[model samples]
Target chain A: MTSLVLAALLYATPAPQANVFTLETHWRAEDGSDRAFSTLKGRPFVLAFIYTSCPGTCPLTTAKLKRLDAALKAQKTPLPMVVVSLDPEHDTPQAVHHYRERYALEHAEHWSVFVGAEAALRTLTQLLDFKYAQNPESKQIMHDNTVYLISRGGEVLTALSSLDDSSAPLLEQAAQSEGKQR
Target chain B: MVRLAALAIGVLLSSATRAEGVLLPEGRFAPLFGLDKGQRSFAVAAFRLDRRLVTEAAFAAFLRSKPEWSSASVKPALADERYLSQEGGAAYAQAPQTRVSWFAAQAYCEWRGGRLPTTLEWEYAAAADEKVRDASTDAAFVKRILTWYGKPFRREDLLGSGSLANVYGVEQLHGLVWEWTLDFNGTFMTSDNRQDGDRVNALTCGNGATGSARREDYAAFMRYALRSSLSARSTLANLGFRCAYPATEERSP
Candidate 1:
């Protein structure tokens, strides 16, 4: 149908290539650069999904990521990070920066914060195997507190639940990748 | 003069639409599956669904166009080793191509000028029996569906894409393969489903019902459970998919 053709064209924007790089999906980083996901490569990165206003799991997820961040620092390993916002409406660039400051992770290695159009968010989340839903009534987003470890080659190494004490393996993998890159 | 011009435009549009599939009109659908709020009704926008389950031949044709999606070319991260493992070449070409990941299904649909239907849209359309809508409560109908549910999918089954037409003229939605919804992972659940006391209560009826929420709907409940268990890269021997698109000029406003 002509409508189907039109829909396909609409979806044929910049990305959704069904690959790990997802490099074509563009976003506005907290620092205000028009960046693509491919630019986030060349270092072992941790991709964590959170929204600033989440009262439940989002905070816990960050705390867990921060712990991992601290451990990586202690081990002299640089963990490049990108904490994506599930609620770009509330967690704007300014809010993400505030979060960075609040966590005292401002000086941490490459923990770039981002807020962008829902389309880029969806593409990234889908590639990361993340599932999230926003509840308008409760004003809370329902999702898993998931953290993904990305290898230097852009493969998603593993997806770990943030509530667990199982950062040991992820830490070791990231450290090894860090050594190879240097 | 305006009326005549509008009619002329409509004539041209109908002719254009006739080039492919038919449109299922807009309606209010209480999905028997998916992120359902208890007794909550949701809108099903007007859309067009491909009349058939994507067949192996169709997929093979798709692969010819998208070399990167070929079984040998796709990396393990994007797809598993079992992708097209049993491809019998032209012999089994018409069989419904199973053992495909969600990404592959999406790409196939995109190539076909549509997309994989959302769980809500799939459920909304499937609730109909031949000649009646919302046959969910119809005992005979539900029993027939359950029969297919209990029946195991034989790998040898061929997808003709012309049988078992529902009221909307959609085919092979059931008694065929478990089709993939575009956002299959959106159905959420707690790992500790057996948790006792307040924890269980909060997880279940917290916002509304989730994971085995509609226990009475044994079939639909199982579907949700299966969907939640699968990751985006999961491929199955019995799972395939169909495509859909928003209806032309769908003025939801």
Candidate 2:
């Protein structure tokens, strides 16, 4: 505790915020195109993680994202969305594409599905505080099904952990945090 | 040229010694909480682990090399103000570096040419006692480990890097501070964290796919509970970490 008092004296204020989106986290799209999350800078977006073969909550998570997107469009202009696969080993580009199709999100404007190496996914997960686990017995990946809404400046506006939570508040918060050109 | 080659090997050997890590041969051991409740044995590739919990001094040196990781430099996004508090000063450097965020711990391991051990690697290597490889079933050992959990943390108790080495010479897997696992969030015990909509069920009904392998291990259950309660940016007073590296070559018998 003494160190804390000394540290507080040494640091009168907290450090400045860091950019959440950077060119480092690159993803391979269903079309085999690679892009970093930083490429979406100056654009508000939502990020979700799922896998095609997941037997548990992945499908329900996607459906919620769908509703969220629809709600956002109904209120304001549609925002950009990206659904990443937590099971990158099984979630090939083709698998993500089929998964997107399974949700009837085909050609959904500003919404893209991408798959990449676990290394890249790991970096993104770190940035977003996203956590996932694979069960050896079930061969199924378990993860925190949470969606991160990022403002134009790459600031995480809020995180919705429960699927039952309303998207209206998150969209409203995003609306307030968007596009001042950081 | 012979002398020069010998000097190069000397430097390499000395640097490896400075790191003070021990190798655990590749083997299979049941995790405290396996995927199923049966406690079936699973294979874990060999790896190296630090002999002791990382000290505040060791972490401060790392921060000096990478100021972006410094408590003063890391933003609120990556870490909260609690990243390095009063215990962050030079005087306390000899103590175990607690209240470290998981991201910071991961970076420290990487900086040292290692990474945090996966959940299984940690549990497997920790199962060893000084005399036997898997001493987890021993009633005395199990009780001793669980007893550590019951004791409340005191500043006097956590102020050092000293911990008894296990059979494999890995130290403080249980009695010391709670170390970070590479896959801390990988284990499932509480609920389906991935599921989105909760309104329909709201009554604790899961799809029945997820369950712990060793449900009786209350100590492991507490470990998972604590881990699940934390986020990547968390910096708790009693939470610290050590580094682990992948085992590249087999140790000749």
Candidate 3:
């Protein structure tokens, strides 16, 4: 109860929103090809980080993205999803290809899996204020289970930890915001 | 009267420690051959699993002894290699195997001269303390414990130790891997001739919401539907299992 009260107080304090998304970051393709996000040329993008081997939270996270994709498609929305792998060492182009196939992610024009060197990925995650700590002794990483929503113009729109059907309203709000900016 | 009731509740909440291997009368149920008049007509057997979870070393020996059994496929994402290590070599094996399918777990028990305990038996063991399911205990007690001023002894990083064992020596029946039981398809509400491990989606059905469950776990007829939705090959980072055997002596508590 005390923690909840403290959290509410902290939330009330107005903190300036930081520019967490950088378009210059290089991203990899499901085919093992590398390219800069700037090359995508200002197309609105939704991004999430995941490893295929995770079953607990990762699967649920992927399902959320899938749900979001379906919602956008139903509305004929143009935003695409960019999935970056945290386990870059294992998630090869071929592995990502397999994952895409398994998840029926044939929506290639709307989705892409990116893999890069460990340091590059780590730097980007840190810049975004993503918290992931590897317990060296246990070889396990404890990370905040958050999904980042990024706009094409390199702005972090929102951070979502729980993705349910109720998020459709938030999606609509974001879409409206994007329309106003255009 | 209120004070008396409060004292009774307090005493009920924290008074008993489970005796090792002494099967409490209601501690377990025997598997039945079939049902009669809505009650399982078959004689319930006494199944008291080992006091400790089968260690990695023991499972490793089983795998080595029977090369025919398929081992966990090695992947870069998989951190633990020793699925059943006794000495705790690496944390991967120490954490417990999550992706193992129900069939594969059953195979391990058969190889080890035992069988997996039925779901009823497993729950009985977990409920060894009569108040185990009573959720009315004060959360303030937990908060009070955390505010202590003196040095406290704490066990760290050990999975399923003997301290958590039940009266019949069954450890970690809850909050661990959702064990695959022999009676997989039995209804939780009333006894029926249902398939074991049958999967059904019942989220839309008006059965009251369960205490937080996996979203995908929502299925079947009013929470009585069995889980067959999970892929047999898929393993999760949180899943681990234990095996059980029939007691040598047919002594009823």
Candidate 4:
């Protein structure tokens, strides 16, 4: 009977794959719509975390994303990009709009900017192994500057630091993911 | 006599609910890491902390309630292969539940209407001794903690073994399993170097130690290093966690 029970338990176990969409989190998109991360599944996308008001590496990360977007477009394998805010308290819809305009992402249909409460953000960030902490006094966020290429199943296929590493690897994987989707 | 009995029952109910955890007063503490430039100490708010580590039986109860977090169902990305390997039998019911990933710990705390304590808050509460609060600077106390750290770990030791209650009435901070903090991955060494325009190789050259507030506090340093080394999914046999809750607002009579 114990062996039979063990076999049943073994059969019940599901195949393990890391999918960020599996996390239960909600966010407000730049368009003022409440969306669950699962909505982004079934399509390959580039994911990055940044706050609209970050004075340091965030702007660099945005510029890097733009460059990656243009590079992927040239390869005819354009993937949608997701930019989540680390400072959800300050990254209101208006702030995200201004940020999109400032970075010339206003007309980019493939780009999405999202802001959510800290708890939801933490759930996503922890899933991706992204680290961030906000200073209590200065309110400036210290964070890693990695850009990820997520597969259609929401697994991180490749990640590269925006400041130090070239986006060539991420671009290659994103192109491959786009090809698979097609 | 009837009125007195009713009042006594009311007091008993209140104390029973409160016995699950202990309240720690607000204070400032200088942790081993995460201090900004020229920042000395972090101001921690008053909070309630669990009196003991979560036990195997408690975790079993959680797994029963949330089957998705069970070893068979949890995603590999959220917890490693060793997740919940310690079986909860009658013999080990009271033992501290180890081999739990940070995500599982967080979920358990949330289910209990609380959250994992921040690193600063955990360190501040842990600094207290049995008689004196903030005994982190006492050389003898530091030595005793270091001794505990050096002792060879045995899983059997987790049973019926824990530190005496500190000033906050919280026990088992040391000489027990390592606990998870809310932001265990928030170690700012490599990321801070990029912000300061310093080469990443500087961390390898022992420059990370230069930012520590107390170089002699090797126990704290080890804890910080362990926290930095762990991913959200990493689980260790000697690692467990307790929950913390926001302090209730005091009202004047």
lDDT of 2 at A177: 61
TM-score of chain B taken alone, candidate 3: 0.51
Q: Tens-digit lDDT track for model 1 on B1-253?
A: 9988966764564334334354788887655433335545567778998776777766776786788989888756566556777656777665778888887888777665667877878878887889886776667877777766666555665544423788888878777677788777665553333432212222343332333334345556546555655555667777788878768824221
Q: Against the correct fold, how does model 3 do in TM-score?
A: 0.37
Model 3 / residue A20 / CA error / Å: 4.0
Q: Pick the candidate with the highest lDDT.
A: 4
lDDT of each: 0.68, 0.70, 0.47, 0.79
Better of 1 and 3 by DockQ: 1
Question: Ten-residue segment with the worst summed lDDT in candidate 1 chain A?
Answer: A1-10
Cα deviation of B241, candidate 3, in Å: 44
Q: Predict model 3's lDDT versus the native.
A: 0.47
Question: Across residues A1-182, which tens digit of lDDT does each residue of candidate 2 receive?
Answer: 22322332344343344345632577887678877777888777888888899887888888888888888877665788888878777887677767867888777868887777655676577676566767654667767778878777776777887776767778887666653432
DockQ of each: 0.16, 0.25, 0.01, 0.22
Query: What 10-residue stretch in candidate 1 chain B is worst by lDDT?
Result: B194-203
What TM-score does chain B of candidate 2 reach? 0.81
Flag regions of model 1 displaced more than 4 Å: A1-34, A66-78, A87-109, A114-128, A133-140, A155-160, A164-182, B1-22, B32-39, B87-95, B160-163, B189-213, B248-253
**Cα miss at B20, model 2 (Å)?**
3.8
Candidate 2 global TM-score: 0.76
Using TM-score as the measure, the top candidate is 4
Better of 3 and 4 by DockQ: 4
Between prediction 2 and prediction 3, the one with superior DockQ is 2
- Tens-place lDDT digits, model 3, residues B1-253: 9988966653443121111233424322222211222442123346546444444544554565565443554221111232222233555344444445444555566655455555555544543432342111224322222232111212122354322544444555443334455434332222221321221222223332332222222211111222222222223333345666656634322
- Cα lDDT tens digits, model 4, B152-252, are 67777788577889998888999888889998877664423454331232233366576678777777776776676577787877789998887992321
